[model samples]
Target: MHLGKKKAFIFIAIACVCAGVFFALKTSNNTVKISYDPNDGSSKTTTKTVYSKQGQTVQDLLKNNGYSVDKDLYYYSTSLADQASKIHNVRIVKKANGVITIGDKKIRYSSVQKTISDLLDEKNIKINKDDIVTPGTSTLLTSKIKNINVVRVTKAQVASSEDIPYQTEVVADSNVTQGSSKVEQSGQNGQKTVVSEAVYHNGVLVSEKVKSTSVKTEPVKMKVSLNPSDIAANTSSRGSTSSISSVDSSNASSTSSSQASTSTDSAGKSTAATIGDNTSKSKGVAEIKDDSKSATVKDTTQKSETSTKAPDSSNTSNNQAASSASESSNNASMTETSKKSDENSNTSEKSDSSTITKTSTVNIPFKTCNVYVSNLAKGTTQITTQGVNGEKTVTTEMTYKDGNLVSQKEISSTITKQPVTQVVAVGTKEEQTTTQSTDSNQSGTTATSASTSSSSASAPSSSSGNTQSSLSQYVSQTKNVTYNHKTENISASDFDFLCAVVSQEDNSGYEGALAVISCIMNRADSGKWGGSTAVSVVKAEGQFSAYGDGNYTKYLNGKSSAAVQAAVKDCVYGGVRNHSYYSFQAKAKTTKSVKIGGNYYQ
Candidate 1:
């Protein structure tokens, strides 16, 4: 009984010690309740109870457990160890990772960066100010931002050359033959150096800007001369007239002489004349010299006896009357001859014989005759003989009726000097072609002795058979040339604008006008005052002085001369005379600017 009682006491004491140790362990350890919701949106909560010492952190507890805490996730209590004495509830949220693409490179990152800029900084990627970013640097880095694109932008200057073609100008020439043309000046291409700034995005060209342009060489205009059809026809007519004159020389001379003789005879025989004296019983014939030349008179009358028987008072009166009548008739005859001679001397034509009774000396003009010849150059004149004035003495016969002169006549004419014929040679040689041949040995070597014969012949002469044709009114010379510069194509409106500006600004000459055009083009290429286009540069406000008062507008609407157009073309295609010059004005006293055309430029 004593041994049984001792064993029971020892068991009760050991059980009491084990119960105290369990109570101490339950009070010392802490319980952490972790709650999390899956991203699947299910209304279910996951609870995790972690038992640890009061000093253990949430991060430590999560790491110790199989649950990993994402860096991008949120935890309700980050410092659980400090709050362990007060609370034990811990909440955590899962965050998604995002992809960023930067200039063909892709990267995966968490949302911890908060912003794109921060993300880039963390990745150590640099971007230029001009670079393009799909997601702005200030944008928040969230799961919604799945893609981030970065484009590298760059600028570069590119240079190249383009050719400018020359223009053609036509001029009318009457001297050139019809249906033909001549090139006075040949056309040449011009050169232009173009500088452009190119914009590149991600190593690909996106856009280009014109930086500057310069003309290396100017184009040379082509000049062509054309003849009118009418001029050619006129020249042919002149040739034919010259030929006819040569063939009809002799006939013309003979006809001229016959006309002169016939005219003289008709004048002399204009009227009939007779000479008479005062005595009734006797008729007297008198001869007079006329101014035309020599003259003679003939009278048909029988000699009659004078009255011898005397009467008383009646007879005395009759005798007195007869004596008075005879005296009056003689006086009248002499007066009439004098008047006729005066008229003949003043005028080469014969006077009325019935009214003229006297003659006088006179001078006559000599005639000119032409003789044509062939086989000589046209417009050639040879004076075979010289003409001199002739003097002539004229005689006339007169008749009196009732004591008054009634008729008169001229008998002959004498020439002191004769007229001469003029001789002229005309060209009849038509333009012809001849060919000749020459023999030459290709090698400088002697051949073996051999019999050789040669013969000479003369060509037969042939006439041109009076065939005539006109010659060209003008002569044309042609030339061809290659340009040293290149050229570029331009719109018609732009070209017209250039032409108008040049015409108004520099009407001095082609060279001066071209200088003005060059200045404007230079300004356009400079990219300073105005736009790069020609029209923009020219129309720039306050740039061209002509545009100040709307004059430039007027000029643009007006017609431009061919010369100005040609000059503008040359300048547009070619480079400026001095590429450095950008301003020009009318010539003045100042010497700061260089002179070109009539204007000064700097």
Candidate 2:
């Protein structure tokens, strides 16, 4: 038969030149466009373009737009024609002059409530009456060109995990395995978040980040909240009594709006001062880890890393839970072992089991979280911004071991900026360990004294995970500041009792109060109040969690009571020489952190 039709015309011209050189180099490097409609009630302009062939995705245009981008939005379907085209594409088009479009959004309705379940149960719009809506709302509507596209349905955030299962402690020549640090991996968050995303056409907030972020099954590192300079026996209970008795350069601008005569170092002990900062110059990095692995010790002493995640966190407050499983398998790898005279700076050899092995990073320097990230959906958020809406793209993730943070993550990428409403992480810093192990093959010097006793047990693995020597307990903390003396007006009544009782029940916004103001600015108020500037102005608004936002809703609607009496008449009239450190809230009863001191500053 003519030689089998010339070998089927050379296998149909090599499958049409390998499908025309893969769709002409994937349609000139991807064009991207997909969105469709047609389950019998089809309308909202009936999208369904779905282009990307030979590869095809936007996750196959969301399994052909019946939805399933994973990490959250799911509904696979048994295909009763995709559950009757997802119930006639979620119907609701009423209009006998009272306008009600639903999908493109017209709203103003009246008669027949047209089905998508009587227009989301007569416009309350909650849906879940056992979901499923098709043009069979009794299949009536004759024309409005077929409306039905108001799909607000959302649900994705159920990926949470924490295994950390790999930690060995043989190190005998007197405890040696030391180099590594990062071991971070805060994944396993189905802490679900769909605030909005049913199919936005233009504004573009369509999220679907479901890689599920794995690989922590056995990574271990869990230090614990301690850095008031590492607690030298917490100097008389983390010291500092703020008593400046004299730099009264007229009471030093009278504490720019009363944190309670908030400034006193000429002798009384307020600690630090100077708040001229127009800010700018804070490269932002609460913790990505490693600015040369800091913490050579100087932590000063304080320990309290409380992370309830907002008391189970609001509706799962950005959903963060997955960190209690630990077998502790630390392969520990940060190999520095230096003494370089300079053989071309030790060439670069050591990470090559044939590549791909990155799981150790300990940049350590955090000693500054007072647990404060208050209603901050505006600008200046680090670990990458998230003031929330009005400006979005908020992504979050956390999983540190040896340095503390076993779990806490947020995922909402695109990373928006400047419309911050609320996000306050006041203070947090925990890397406490009390290790003290020693016993290996009952040592008696064999083989060059076993490599100098494993190089002096790995040159002091920075207190080797707190070695447990003296009943090992590094830091466990709780700090409180509550200066009281007042018939009121102690600086506009102490900045309205610290903007209404301690910035609202002491924020869950997180930061652990800047590690209790860095263990009260590295301790020893030498006669009290080290280096001064009002303890460096609330330690720079307790480590600046993006200062403030949306006028914090005019300081939460009370229209910021005349900006808290112009910040207590600009801290009692120096108009706050160069804005004496800001961030003071109002509308109070008592939250606590007042200053005046012992018998009202004597």
Candidate 3:
């Protein structure tokens, strides 16, 4: 028994030695080399060869070795949780191959392309040296990146010629008759050459800056004379008129203070001449008095007469005879003077008694209209049609006393040009909202917040789905109608007409209704089809199927659903929009057409 025990011990020792050798071989075979690189601009790398046990992963190896890595860094060769079986070389680096947009194109570049510059070379997207690139050419491509914009910048010096319009100048001239005027100088358009640097983005003109401008031809100013009649024709009842007339040198010194005249009598005293019924004596009183001081002046009826004082009653008979001869000569001279004065008085009465009437033009202000647009940003406005003032003809009668303004009144006014309405497009496009939830195990607070955000987002999504369902159900029950109704932009009547059209044409709910309204709004903003208003666009002939067929009129008479009414109002006033189409048919017939609801919009 002792001999048997010795032999068994030796055999067991050898078997144990063989089992240890096999275990060492298996351990060495499962060993892996791990290299930790911070890769943060510093060339520091740590390499380690660890004996991996069965079922042990790379993540566990890192934990046991106390090697803490960045959260963004990961195993370059394989997954961290994967078994480290026969791993030759393991590295830590940031992951790549995320989606990124370059201009309008999207690409998910491979990790092999390292940088944006390298990716562009691989994709064969050539960019000019002056072209702008977002981020940087040396920037590394990774999952954190979202977009890459490449702006193609091209510049050119362009010379273009433009015509300069001439300006008109009006000059008031009394020599130009009341109704007659002449253009002193005729106007001619001039030319100018402008040198500018034009910038283009992706073959589309973006900006142009003028470097210099040279006048090819100088513009001429138009000189015109003002007509005096225009002032009288445009007279208002509250305004006055002043007559302007050219007078001869003989009457230039005459004053219009009064009609009576003063004279020195034979007694060396001043006498005031009074006007009478005698036409000959009444004309030019000063001249008649100077002609003969001793002669007796008589009225037309011979009932009144005036004679200068007898030249000093103490004079001798010879003196009296000489005085008598002088009186006869003076009387003859007075008679001739009276005839001349009578002729002048008749001419003055003819001019003073007549009234002149004139006709002129005035401007009328245009009305402004507000239109909603879905594509434009809120609070922004664009003028689609310019406001033009209208013209109207006004006639007035003016009366003047002497050579001064007396009174004026408006006679009549008629519209010559109709005022054009101003159309302004008000932006109503709402900003889109996006919900993002990110989870992280490193912080409990972050994870909790992410969960809360995710739940909050779900509520809105569910409510939106329910609302959509309700709209769909309401539209399906309604039918199209054909009738006409007049409406204005943003007015109560406009709201009614919009609702009727939406309910009649669309059976797809809010989306369909919005599409119809958008089309109408687009047409109205363009002012091309029918008119520049929502009401006019909808009621246009052959524009909508429901109008003029009696069905639309019936719908208008009845009440529209609350949902349909809300959609119409929101689109017209609140700025809700879906499609910016002007016309629609049963199906899409062109490449520019888009299908919405039951029709194609273009």
Model number with the top lDDT: 3
Candidate 3 residue-wise lDDT at 554: 41
Candidate 1 residues 1-602, lDDT tens each? 89999999999999999999987676557787887744333446688887866566667776776666665554344564454433477776554366767556788765545578888888887989998887789976654566788888988786755545455454569775444445576555577877879787776545667899999999776555544442121112211110000112123211111111212111111111111111122122223433234333333321112333333432223323233222233233212222112221233332222223344443444432222223222222222223344444443334333334443344334443332211111222232212222333877565544332121111111331211112111101111211222333465555656766776676654566667766776677777977676668877887775654445554452245434554554445432232347887553325677776666777
lDDT of 3: 0.51
TM-score for each predicted model, relative to the true structure:
0.30, 0.16, 0.33
Q: Who wins the TM-score comparison?
A: 3
Q: After superposition, how far is residue 363 of candidate 3 from its true place, in Å?
A: 23
Residue by residue across 445-509, what tens digits does model 3's lDDT show?
44222111111111012224311110112222334311112222354455556777776666344
lDDT of 2: 0.27
After aligning candidate 2 to the native by TM-score, how far in Å is the CA of 474 from where it should be? 36
Instruction: Please provide, for model 2 over 440-526, each residue's C-alpha lDDT reduced to its tens digit, 9 standing for 90 to 100.
Output: 566743432211111111001133421111100111222232111111122322333333322222221112222222222222122
Q: How far out, in Å, is residue 452 in model 1? A: 38
lDDT of the candidates, in the order given: 0.48, 0.27, 0.51
Evaluate model 3: give its TM-score. 0.33
Q: Where does model 1 exceed 4 Å of error?
A: 1-96, 175-180, 227-602
